[model samples]
Target: MSKQVVFHIGGWSSCGFYSKASNVLASLSILFPSRLKVVDHKYGSRDEYRSWLIGTSGSGFRDTFGISKASNQTSSPFAWIESSDGGNSFVGGCDDTLAWCKDFCAPKEEGGEEKAVHVDDGHTKGHGYDYDLVVIGGGSGGMAASKEAAKFGAKVAVLDFVKPSPAGSTWGLGGTCVNVGCIPKKLMHNAALIGEILSSDTEPFGFTAPQALEKGHSWEKMREAVQNHIRGLNFNYRVTLREKEVTYLNKLGKFVDAHTLSLTDKKGKVSQITSSRFIIATGGRPSPLNCEGGELAISSDDIFSLEQNPGKTLCVGASYIALECAGFLAGIGVDTEVAVRSILLRGFDREIADKIGAHMEDHGVKFRKGVVPAKLEKNGEGKIEVTFSDGTKDVYDTVFAAIGRSADTGKLGVENINLKVNERNGKIPTKFEQTSVPNVYAIGDVMEGCPELTPVAIQAGRHLARRLFDGSTTPMDYKNICTTVFTPMEFGTVGYNEEDAKEKFGCGSYEVYHSSFNPLEWSLSEHRGKHPAFAKVIVNKDTDAVLGIHYLGPHAGEVTQGFGVAMKKGVTYNDLLDTVGIHPTSAEVLTDLTVSKSSGKSADAKGC
Candidate 1:
């Protein structure tokens, strides 16, 4: 007698996985060797099948056929585990079944099975390295990429340098963002911003104290505390990585072949690993300015370790980093001067960036616009003389070089592989985190597209994990990615800029809505100037659809995130109107704008 097997392509909500299984079964028939008949569940009603899978949300698959449980049976709360290998193996049902039974799984003594697997798109690929996945640079992208692939039953291994950062004695499993780069920097930025608020706002608000606000906090102590928090997170990340059963190599990894890697530990020991797929997320480092006497300048990495603040500082570059450092110095009563070759913060909203420059100047930051640093020379008096392209020179105590960062792909043997890196800016070329080689992927600053923000890196890493390991083949859409700067008053933006929209869609087709106001928090302050918040929306005049949203204010980053989500979901101006505003909140200003009623421009008088 031929054995008959029925394939049920029910609405299991596994996103067509059951249909995929049916296709797999059809393919398996030719290879099964044994004679078997397959039945389709076409005749069963959808309601009946759903009821079968979720009868009580408890015992969804109790022996409806009156079969008794074996004396030595392992009981799992899943709907059923109908293994092709019979009672020798067990496979849990759909995600709903797992969710239903998750909390009820019994103790080890009662012979209960382990918790059912989630089987999301992130776990589509089977675990292990015999499978096609290879993850390079065990930072955020690498760890997440490898772990997700491993969960999908794909063989995954991460090659990363476990070399400790000078910022901390040890490294975390999550990589740069969590360990040394963004996370630590952001924490310091937060602390510094608070210090600025106390200094700039407290006295004006009639909140006097015996001690000066600047003396109320120590930058060194804050740095140590922030470092401690980062170290703790690193430890927790290691524990989580171990629980996920990921293969982590404590060595420097480089591309050896299209699907192979060479890992070298600090001890000069080397090991080789191969995989069918690979990912490159090594990220980037601060670029060297290469000016004469450049060694006298300090990069962003040294800022956290500064034992004493520079009494007078000249910051080079109009980049966000440079502006930020200048702002911090100005806040702390330093004679700060920011010099830029041309426009400050190129690629940023020109008007807003200029206004910010004006604000900086108002707060005592001198702007040396359209000036090039020819060279730097340290005099005997411990003052640094910086000469400009026009043969002019002035002296300051310190110089900060904040030009930009470059992709860290060159030394990683990426050139040896099939990967084609773009020569324009020397970044690994990728289409939505995919590299030249099909198996190898790239994300973060190591590759290009979108702003080089930590959140962008995390998103790319997480999304790649879902697509490769969880069976989600969806590509990440970069549209409406929110971004911010941690300067005095935070700036946040999402979607197209006014110029970008006009360039892409023409100015006649769009309208702008903008507003600036002093926040309620500053009501009691003697500095009655507007709190320096602006909300601008670019919209298609015909459809009333919001093309972009830009905000400058406190918590701008957090507020813009929700707007980013709305833009991603294709939310329109009418949608904005329909949603009830959260009263007395800074975000409500986004909804309060009436484009047709006013000039749709900020009222604050422009000054520089």
Candidate 2:
């Protein structure tokens, strides 16, 4: 409650807008010494401010205020409000900033002294329930919603419990990204990349690796470090909840009724609690392999914390999980193979997925096509003996099942309230995450048809909280959701794929502009694999509207993010050409795309 609010005001020196905005903000900061402070950044020009922001806070600052280096319009200074709680809310450009500061100080500046962000006492009352908001599953979405609701003075409780995997793997809060999915996966993926650099990438750069490379990777050490980092994050989330005054219970919650939930601890002790509203964000677990001796294979839940190096790994399935695991395993000097019964990265752009598969093949990863694991059993040597559907068998020290993920709604007692769950994926069907029961909602992977992404879930949760507590009507936009598959050569994509675009716009309605280029970073490496990285943009010919953007190369996630914002704003193909590109970067290839896939012309890069 004693936390100070900071206004980071960025502007050009000597500009009238900056002077006026500074005066308004200065008045507020001076009046409310304990509550408000202004950090003034004056630059020689608008571009100087842009350069300063980028140099100071990098992408985070640029993204917060939508500071475009490309923008030439010097309309007004940009301002953002940062609370001591580390919550950031944009206050907008000069005009909006002055208006907001005026509103805050007007009450005291005129006659009445009032709090800046005063929440009505009516918003805090629990309406006769034990809590105002009871969030089940202490994952990212639930954590965010609970904390935001608490900001509105609403009482919130978050219950989270990790049921041990079949292999007994369990972790604390922050959900899949922190515990098992993105965090650990990226750590291992980067480790594999480093291993590749040490083994070969160093030669071209005229450097030798440490002698440890000769002995190969130590999976035990990597596992230890990654798990330790994850644990720290988990602890921090717990502390964060405490600091926000949001009650957190390390217990599993099941619906006792529409308004009540049964909390059961690991010891099987049970208690009942009630809330005026509930949000389900239990997330998902890796699906079981579902075959004879399938339990013998480990899931992603066990891979991160594995006690021993997974030697000669056979990753079964074609999901990103499967390919990523295989990529890292092979990169670290372990023999790795992926078994596929169908296409790779289903629901993603198939061309990009096939390219990823080929890139993996060019590396050390092998593929066993047209075969699913029919059986998994221990051989005489105590290794996993995997029998394929084709009756072929292979033995391995470990087997990983990355078939898919199933939502954790089965045990939540959704049936008790007649909440409909998509029987196929066990995901709840919701209208903007609201279930059939008006009081209950769902987010994250558990929501039917929702993008199964952590950030999406987090945004949905925070936006839902604003709607519920602050009376906002902004719905979560699900279109053009950007995603990346972190294989050896990562694939980042947003909007529709080629096939999907064709399906939506008819075959002749849309045009595909694609290019293949060797990233300058890879040009020096002699071992730059078989295929050059690729980029493609699908545009509607009728309106020149950019329908989709896809890229495969290094740091694909970083490259796709800015394009995602553009896609959200309905950026057109002509818009891409009009934008100047930062040269020699992989992202620039997108802006320079000229070859049409329909033209039957070579999409390969023209000579430099």
- Segments in model 1 whose C-alpha atoms lie over 4 Å from true places: 1-132, 162-173, 203-206, 210-217, 381-383, 528-531, 595-608
Candidate 2 lDDT (Cα, whole model)? Answer: 0.84
**Backbone clashes in model 2:** 0
- lDDT of the candidates, in the order given: 0.66, 0.84
The superposed Cα distance between candidate 2 and the true structure at residue 300, in angstroms, equals 0.7
What TM-score number comes out for model 2? 0.79
Q: Against the true structure, whose TM-score is highest?
A: 2
Per-residue accuracy of model 1 over 482-559 as CA lDDT, tens digit each: 888766677888877877887977868787777776666654565536346778788777556688888887788889
- The TM-scores of all predictions, comma-separated, are 0.73, 0.79
Please give, for residues 314-345, the per-residue lDDT of candidate 2 as tens digits: 99999888998899888888899999998999
